[model samples]
Target chain A: MSSNLILLVSLLAGLLLGFFTKPAANRARLANRLLMATILVLIFMMGARLGLMPDLGERILAYGRAAIVITISALIFSIIAVRILVWLFMRKRGGEL
Target chain B: MMLLAIISCLLLGLGAAYIGLMPPEVAVFVNEAPFYCLCAMLFIVGYGMGQDKNTLRGLFKENAFVFLVPVGTIIGTLVGGLLAGLILPLGIRESMAVAGGFGWYTYSAVYLAEMHSADLGAIAFLSNVSREMLAIILIPAVVRFFGAYPAVSICGATSMDVTLPLLAHYAGSKIGAAAFLHGAVLSFVTPLLLPLLIGF
Candidate 1:
């Protein structure tokens, strides 16, 4: 009954169903819209919960700093690694592909 | 547009709660809604993955270089997390857990909230969301300057869905399959990686 367990179960179920059904374009579109709505609701709920916390301002400031730092580092490192890989692997192919 | 909507929704919820508009009865629903909503979102994500037979099949047969994009992303993001740990106040494991989300913010945040503290979960959420925002801004520039691989890899798990169109537009349609496969691979790894990092 854990959240992760719930997530895994739901994902597996959907994967199996979609794999078998191979839903048509219309149904797939509907699912995408539904997914967007669900994500928005989840984000809203997350925000509301955080908003209800006592030290919201201070926590956001502290967490926001970490968020920005981690994001930049992740981007920098990813670009470096991928750049090296591309040069090693794709340079022979030539052109900006 | 999607990012705009996401931020707007978050702000609206924050504003709603800040203004004391949430009554006691509604607060009960707000407390529990994320669980169900997250389940739904993951289900849809899985379904999309299942539907994309080409991306999965291509993973096995495509030029091995395409696979390297996600590999680079995983390596770089975790290393960045480790480095951030050294400087920031957070421990290595916690910093890695936050980075390990790999841009799948909803699942990581919710999982950490349940397993650790809500504060850590919030940090994960903000960090991953910020990564997505950064990806949106950087994708075009990265494609123009760095190359398609970095541009696609920079998107983390969002390359397939949220940023696919942009990737296609900027990086060109030739790179679309590689980009989708890159995102799909990262998305698959995130759920497995986060729990191990947090639980350890």
Candidate 2:
């Protein structure tokens, strides 16, 4: 089948399944379980196709430097922002330090 | 349910690996990890929605402070991105800034990797994902030990998804509502601001 056709069918199926499933505990659990199962199967298939395992270590090493820089910068920025905002708010409201 | 979500994600990773063995044409959707990850996210969202109507209703209120947190976070993200761009090497700066803003490396990392190259993309992914995981684990203690505004800021871009729920669960429910609103708005704004600031 064509990509468009597949997409259309999947979309319809998803909607139909979603609509038919009542939001009760038993039904929701069943739906979640099915979805989880499908996700697992899909992931395994994708990994096999891509040969993810062998390249994993190399990918990590290659990307390590850049990742560290980004993570540290983002973390520091977030922390400072939170601190300054809290300080300003506290001062405005005359709250304790 | 949260445990179920984690298991589902793991299952998804395994499934993606299995699907990888198939011919590309035969497994279009499953071949794309991001697309499948998104599907997982959507299901998680739906499941959360299914469980609680009150979640939506509680989002709005007088004491919520919805506007304040976003304003603070966005300002923080933009300034932070600008600083990172200036100081960090040029290669992965834009992706990093964007990840910093939204706190989800997966989307930006994948996009940057595909558009630019794998090296930068992987960096973005790892960094952003780390930020998200850290926020999830730390935000509650930060809030309880410090206060709401600080927790909101500390979690920064990740406040919406990972931290918002954590805050709601641990902090007062009212604070959680405010955090959710702040986080959601920031998620949208971060992408727009990233390019302008970081030149991505």
Q: Evaluated with DockQ, which candidate comes out highest?
A: 1
Q: Which lDDT tens digits does candidate 2 get at residues B1-200?
A: 43345335544553555446445565455445544453453444345343443544566544444566677666565565556656656544564454544564534544454334545555665566666667677777777766666677656655655576677676766676667656656644544454453453
- Model 2, A1-97: lDDT tens per residue? 2422333344345544554555577766676676556544443433343334446656566456655555566556666676666676656764322
Q: How do the residues B1-200 of candidate 1 rate in per-residue lDDT, one tens digit apiece?
A: 87789889888887888788878787788776667777787788888888878668866776777877899999999988889888899788888999988888877776676567778888898999988888988888998899888998888998987888999999889888888888888877887787778773
RMSD over all Cα atoms, model 1: 2.2
Candidate 2, CAPRI quality class derived from DockQ? acceptable
Listing every candidate in turn, what is its Cα RMSD in Å to the true structure after a full C-alpha superposition? 2.2, 6.7
Per-model DockQ: 0.66, 0.24
iRMSD for each candidate structure, in the order shown: 1.9, 6.9
Candidate 2 whole-model C-alpha lDDT, 0 to 1: 0.54
